[model samples]
Target: MHKRKISIYCYLVSAAFIIGLLSISMFISYSKDPTSSAKDDNQLEYVTPEEVGYSSEKLNEA
Candidate 1:
């Protein structure tokens, strides 16, 4: 009787944990997408062109 109770408890706990993890993952991905998430929340920071393999000087020359 004790063994059966323990197994049921374990199953419930595992199911809860899995559901929580899935929800968190979905939230994170949904919030990261620019089109799907709010635009005001996803502000773009200025990054140097050099950091992304483009030369800032050459860009300025154009």
Candidate 2:
């Protein structure tokens, strides 16, 4: 009976450790800068195709 209690405590401690590591990993993954996700520097610009030297009509044809 004493050995069974020890085994149960070991399992509980191991599970708690794994859960703590997973929680930290998730927090780090979610704490990144939102703007850093954009691939292009001009991604935040609100210009039309014609303003950037591209024809809107040509884009519509595709």
Q: Which one wins on lDDT?
A: 2
Clashes of 1: 0
**Residue 18 local lDDT, model 2:** 100
lDDT of 1 by residue, 1-47 (tens): 99999999999999999999999999987774665544565678788
Against the reference, the lDDT scores of all candidates come to: 0.88, 0.89
Q: Please provide, for model 2 over 1-62, each residue's C-alpha lDDT reduced to its tens digit, 9 standing for 90 to 100.
A: 99999999999999999999999999988885666855766557689998889998889999
Query: Residue 23 error for model 1, in Å?
Result: 0.3
Task: Pull out the clashing pairs in model 2.
Answer: none
Q: What's the TM-score of each model vs. the native?
A: 0.51, 0.54
Model 1, residue 58: distance off in Å is: 41
Candidate number of the best TM-score: 2
Q: 55 in model 1: Cα distance from truth in Å? A: 38
Give the C-alpha miss distance for residue 40 in model 2, angstroms. 8.3
